[model samples]
Target: MGFEKAVMVRNSTACAMEWSIELEKALRPKNPGRRIEAIYQIGLRLEQWSGEPEGTMVVYDMFGLVPGEDRLFANTIFLRLADAFQLGNKRDVKSRALALVLFGCWADFAKDSAQIRYLVLSSLVSSNVLEVRASLFATGCFSELADDFSSVVLEMVVNIVTSSETESVVRLAAVRAFAKMGCTFSNANRAFKVS
Candidate 1:
């Protein structure tokens, strides 16, 4: 194993690419410890500005990596980010939450094209607070695409708003998300509004 790595090191390009792919592996949360570290690192990649309204920094600005930019890898880093976000499992919760919030901020290129609708549905139902908020934020940004499942999301959001069990903060976020999705939700609202 050591000898193989030594030979690969001589090929600088391959070495760099190899390491880049290896680094992408870390983006996946293998456990709780790594998720926290990944969240911090991902946060650093996303910019923050006090000038923005309410000092908000919800979007990712391609940070240091762009989708088509030259980089050392067989696959681009953005694709790796998409995969990490797309995993949508409890172990990958933090990074997925981060990705969810960042989605539609720069480009929707990170979305897994094959399972986008499914991804949207799963995101709405996630138990994590951050995941829920992030999903709402992302859906608001991509309300156009979200039109495909706006009714489903709207129904869930309505439940959240009406449910006494839901926290006030989460209920508020749900209302805001519903408003953002109302482009589709409005036409779909007739059913719920009647009662």
Candidate 2:
């Protein structure tokens, strides 16, 4: 069953089959509290769309009628989350992080493109600690594919680590990512020193 079918099966007035304007509002930079709430509710809906449940009941669609979950997710979900994150204010870390997690989930199951790497990698430089951490985690989720994020990931991590003013905690995470990328230490040590 596709996302549309799943939504129809649920038949909730709150979650209409059409793309709700509420979802777009939820992705915006304003209203951090409301953003998190909306993303959490969306996650519940997504679980049924993907069919991997954890300690929750799932509605079985015995007949496969709808025909396009992957395309819908790639087109609409990516737009609402990743594209929104790119356009929204970077200070809105809560929404940024939540969007990343949801976007990563969709990318995990879809036949993703390099376009997504740009979306995820852009989050690496976020001044907000939580957003950067979320981006790093999401990066890991996608790195398992043959996407080849090494240069971009390593370069960003290297810049972060080599920055004299970067927070110790964030620097540590960057170093971890740098290591995971399997790049040599000397390469990162050669940063242009933007101070």
Candidate 3:
């Protein structure tokens, strides 16, 4: 089904939940290509639903899936993030940013604290502009996971903000993400002081 029609039919919490069941089925194909295609389609559908509250809930549901039971999901996220970092346009960057946020949400739900921390740290040091932007969004989304990685993420954010070699836009994005996470300036100062 087309994304627009599917979204129109599944625009509520209940419908999104039902749609997720179907999505899982689609993602369960034995063929690796099929599984990857299903993930790509879901990403596209998510973009269509981005502005709706139900969309966010669907994202949550996507994260709620058990990674061990479906390793393809994790693989899809990694591939998507890699692709996003390679692209150089605003639209691709935003789409990839959202995908990384989804990945962060999944990691948070899975309690993969190390992966979340590693992703932020790696993104901060990346030379690609789009990757840095995606990293900022991913870190902000990781905070929503409310995992034990907040202090780590906050430290990375402060480092990004303070680094002179970082691009201005990337630094600004990090600052926005830091504020979104409601990090305290005093904590940032203390952390920076000790570093």
Candidate 4:
């Protein structure tokens, strides 16, 4: 079963220049949704290479594919970038930081996995001042998290909600994160009741 699944995944990721070029063209236009879609497609393929021999090389290629002057692609690009870091390679710290920022945004949208959530939170909490100044979360980057890292991210949501200094949009993102974490108002209230 595992072999079959792996083969199916590999076939799905078979190299194709046409789609890649098309994605590049859309990225050049800097269309937010289109760029995100391209990133999603590319990420699917990259994810397939998790333990493959050339996985690291493929990830590096993705990083280099980052569209110049395209902010829309920046978000999606960085999400993949973080994966690159996790897989190994500390050669480019700047790229790592950029990717880490995006990873946090992705995790905010991701589901209930303590490890994934902690990975993102660790990145966020340990980020240097310059990364924070980059405003990684300010943009329309993370619409929703997937169900892989939800619980560990809730504390971040709480911080964003309670902090007076946090930006309104950032707070809004926290609200959205809470909703995605499956913590409705009643669940949240129950915690306070116990506290």
Query: Relative to the true structure, how large is the alpha-carbon lDDT of every model?
Result: 0.54, 0.60, 0.56, 0.44
The Cα RMSD of model 2 versus the native structure comes to 6.9
For model 1, how does the per-residue alpha-carbon lDDT over 146-182 read when each residue is reduced to its tens digit?
4545555566677777888777777787777777664
In model 3, state the lDDT of residue 60.
41
Error of 3 at 167 (Å): 1.2
What clash pairs does model 2 have?
none
TM of each candidate vs. truth: 0.57, 0.63, 0.51, 0.38
Residue 60, candidate 2: Cα error in Å is 10
- Please list all clashing residue pairs in model 1, or write none if there are none: none
Q: lDDT of model 3 at residue 69? A: 26
lDDT of 4 by residue, 54-160 (tens): 33344435434332222233333443344444543334344344444445444433323343344455544433433332223412233244422333345555665
lDDT of 2: 0.60
Best by lDDT: 2
Candidates sorted by TM-score, descending order? 2, 1, 3, 4
Give the better candidate number (3 or 4) by TM-score.
Answer: 3
- Estimate, for each residue in 91-173, the C-alpha lDDT of model 3 and write its tens digit: 33444444455565455443354544565567666667876887787777666565345566777777788888888999898
| TM-score winner, 2 or 3 | 2
lDDT of 2 by residue, 2-75 (tens): 87766555432223234345677666646667767877777666655556432222332322223344344335
Better-scoring candidate (lDDT), 1 or 4: 1
